[model samples]
Target: MDKIVLLPDLAKQDNFYQENYLLFLRRKLRAAKIPCQLYLINENTSDNESFVAINNLTDTYYLFDQILGINTLSNPLFLADLKIPTDLIPNFQDSRTDSVTFWQGEQRVLTVKLNKFGWVRQVVSYQSDCFIQDNYDVRGFKITTEYFDKYTSQVLKKEWFNNYGELIMTQQNSSIVIAANQRKRFRQATYNSELEIVKEFLLQHVDDKTLFIADTDPDTINLRLTLPEQFRFCFLITDSATVPVGQNIGRFHNIKYAFRTVSLRDDFLQIAPEVKQEDCQLITPVIEKANLSLSNKLVAKIIYWHTGEILPALIKDYLNQLLTIMSEQKDVELVIDATEVLQAVILQQLNLLIKDAGEKTKPAPINTPAVVNRVSCQTLAFQEEKKLMRQARIYLDTGTKSNFTLQLEALQAGIPQFARQSNGLITPEVNGDLVADNGALPEQLSLFLRSLDKWNNSVIENTRIIEQMKPSQVVEQWRELL
Candidate 1:
């Protein structure tokens, strides 16, 4: 097995060279059906985990160099000792070395050197003549200096290079003209477009079982929410400034709906008041209150900013609504940044309110206890019922137990399982008596029961003559039920 380790040259000044070179190399390698495993080195990579894993699986290593600082080879033990004549060595004043060298035992097979500013200055190889001849079909492109010169000169100006020694520029076509700044802008736009396409492709094909680690960079943060919902979990390490509140709210919406668990950074709460207000408004309907938490520190900060005055009515209403939803959803976790001191202060305030209420209600003992208003209670109940109905529908859609399977079979048979009730009787009349018996159950549950009963009867009737039935007849009957 062979391994191809691709490390981007982050120091490259030209974005075109940095982005396209790897793409071109990878494509050519893949087209040739080379048995190579490619790995990308990112800023977050702290150890040699990828290298060690690849080396364990393969004997040969091919490092794809883009003339970046080749500091990736930190271990000198991996390098081969090859003595080159001093005359062959390129001379430099105040020399600072940066290069990737490949070795097999004591033989130095290849060496690619770059200067301090990350420009390719030299390439040295000591391999046999047969080595170049055997790989000429793949390596022949390196000898075509004119091809690269022609292509690069069109997009890049010679003046862009820091030090031009022996470099020669091809004559620019005078007919078509482009300003320097315009060319730079065009290159940036093209780079961004290509990056987006690659990101989209990776998102579409990402394996569900693997872990995807993304940095808090603006580009990565923007791409995070586009991932598939089926991912088991997602952990994001982000800065408050990189992702705006509007974008955060949108991404949170996806996380709340798609992912089972999400760990948001503490800095996520550090947002502008206006942004916070907008976020609360947008997220209130979609997320349960139990899954939302307003940090007390954040609340106190806001209050302090407002000179300790009470919050605006809109914000107060949003908090109240959130509390109501949270009260109903006990399983969902909402960790607030409330300190022990704040909790104690809240408790003391509540005690004072209770004491005051008790003094006023002493004359009317019968009406002493607080009672919720009927309309508010009804509204809460309605919301709870709606949530339950939604859950029941989801369960019916995805459940796979025997009972659910039977219900699905009945549904396919054109039997209306989710029929409405009229005067305590199941309407559309298939197994009305059975449905009535299960009246204590929820509507969807009752429907499933009735549908299951119908399916059981069909199964029984079909099974009696199952042995006598032809294969086609059995399939037809099953298909009808399905």
Candidate 2:
């Protein structure tokens, strides 16, 4: 049987590897009982087992560092094994920078940084003369250890080690020496780029039966050009913004097809007429169906926002409109679905706007005795956001770039969506509205808010629209593609 191999751009901490199509493909393949392997190219030091645990991926996986010689090391290294000189066993601190400090009595002895996976990323030991930092892999073994001059606080040299604590590589200045063992034969090699090392490793694995589906990144592009022309490969197009259409077609003889969503496929073909339509396969994502039956109907309305890198001016307008709408009718809230950092920034800007607007705008009289703010907004994580989307009356997408995933989520949730730009999901006055002019948002939004019948009709239409991109249908498409 021909096994599908998923190659991601990179598998670093907080890179949203969870949301990548490579894992998505693996998951679908797993459900269908088809053989698939996630081949990681990048050097990931974090505890990737956390990622594997979260995704239920315990079977076939190939890590770049583990493949070389660490495969035989039975005992995995953990933070506990390091046994940093500390009075108390310290808990991993909730840190945005992914670091924590430890003290041995008065002297600060050690500092440990964690990856987003909450595993020990790097451990730095403070000595009287110098500080040494150790970088570990997911296997809980040190990959690299660097010595720094305590006086200058500059790196002296880095020693790379295999999982069994064998010195395999070293780096000083611009020089790097790799000690590779093939068939129990040891040899030292100097390479200009790590891609050379990767090519050598991949050469041992590449066969006629294996299918490599990789992200269309620069690294993969370079790899495709470097590799033998006989190997079959596919470019998984996640976003069209990054991928150039006409360039890759005849550049490599082995690139069999490009996999993308229906909308992305059309967009790709439209941009580059030189590229054939059949070259890009339509493989829509598997979006889980929201169980609306068990969901509670919101007493207050919600405006879900998935616009990435939100401008303060754009948000202020939405807040002003939301506040005005709230003053007239108190049952409304704005939910900005974004990262924690972005959420904080948006809230800080909105607070200033609310303070200024609150002075001028009078609070609307309601039946409740207690006073309430006219402007109401909050942010939720993706999991909570998923639940919130079930009760969302309207979804606002006014960013310059179209967020296809969020658009699909809104479509699945049966929310009346509005977008600055249009995609296959957005149908003006049918399932959702298109915001051609930002100035007309107030009137258009007000019309939708006033008409309950129109809102319900759109929700019904959204149900019909989302049928084409169901998970089962998408998995079937994958079965066909594979």
* The candidate that achieves the highest lDDT relative to the unseen native structure: 2
Model 1 lDDT per residue over 12-59, tens place: 211212232323333444455533333332221112222222332242
* TM-scores for all predictions: 0.23, 0.75
lDDT of candidate 1 at residue 198, scale 0 to 100 = 37
Overall lDDT per candidate, in order of appearance:
0.28, 0.64
lDDT of candidate 2 over 1-482, digit per residue (tens):
58678777553221212456666666777787878787776555664443434232455455555435556433334456677654744544646776777765577778887766566768888888999998887657787789999999888877767677888766677565665543232223665565776777776776766778887777777777787777778877667554564466445554645544465666666665666665567666454654441122656676676656567566656555555555565666556666566566656755555464456453433212221243334555656656766777787877766666567767777767888766677778876788654566656666656677777777777777667767678778766665
- The lDDT of model 2 is 0.64
Q: In model 1, what are the clashing residue pairs, if there are any?
A: none
